[model samples]
Target: MTKEQLCEYRELQKEIKRLQARIEKLKDKNEGYVADVVKGSSIEFPYTQHPILIEGFDAEKKQASISRFKELLSKRVEKSMNRSIEIAEFICNIESVKIRTIFEYRYYDLMTWQQIAYKIGVTDESYPRRIHDKFFEDSPN
Candidate 1:
């Protein structure tokens, strides 16, 4: 084969490898989401024992404050979930299924742009940027 043909073959192989890696990453993300759904809420970090020699704060008051903090956190989580569902529905309405999935996985699932590009079978990192531009182009500013 000519040098040009060999170079093209190598490039094609690289692209295929990149696409395979991206698919694996996306599959892993989907598995994680499925596991989370099956498992319900994840375990929280255990509270550590407070130092015996502390400042002048009351122990009861501290415990009360911690409980209140946890309640606030739970509310925030609920609010965020609701907002995410709203955004996902909006994307579903406007974009193609593939682009919508990429948007949801990247922003809602908190995956990196590279990860999203991989899932969509794109070898280039710039694919995520292009997807974002396309999404926004049809969206109201």
Candidate 2:
């Protein structure tokens, strides 16, 4: 991958991490609803807890918001993965399959360039780095 593409990949990776944390928070918030702990007297309202919402807790509205947040999380994850795959595919589009493998290992699998070189059958770890550099230099505008 080009240096610009690599930067984009890392940015997307960070965004995914941030979004996953949000998803986790939403999941935790949704899971906090337990019928046993709810405050309700039988003589007042006995069906579903609606009028007597817990302070700062609107069960139905909060659940809907959580569900929407989950949907957003799914889309963001898919978008990041898809874009990364597209970049990887572009990196692989050269005549050599090894470049594609190297890019995938580096970006997708989070492997060191040296590890990629080793996996790609290069005796010298720096050889793959040089080849990728040449590839970047030779790329068209």
Best by lDDT: 2
lDDT of 2 by residue, 47-114 (tens): 44434444445678778878987998989988998877777667666677776667667767778777
Candidate 1 lDDT over 76-103, as tens digits, reads: 5555445445555565665477776776
Clash pairs, candidate 2, are none
Clash number by candidate, in order: 0, 0
Question: Which parts of model 1 are misplaced by more than 4 Å?
Answer: 1-71
Summing lDDT over every window of 10 consecutive residues in candidate 2, give the lowest-scoring window. 30-39
TM-score of each: 0.42, 0.62
Give candidates' CA RMSD values in order. Answer: 20.8, 6.8
Off by over 4 Å in 2: 10-14, 17-21, 30-57
In model 1, how large is the Cα lDDT of residue 52? Answer: 41
Indicate which candidate wins on TM-score.
Answer: 2
- Residue 119 shift from truth in candidate 2, angstroms: 2.6
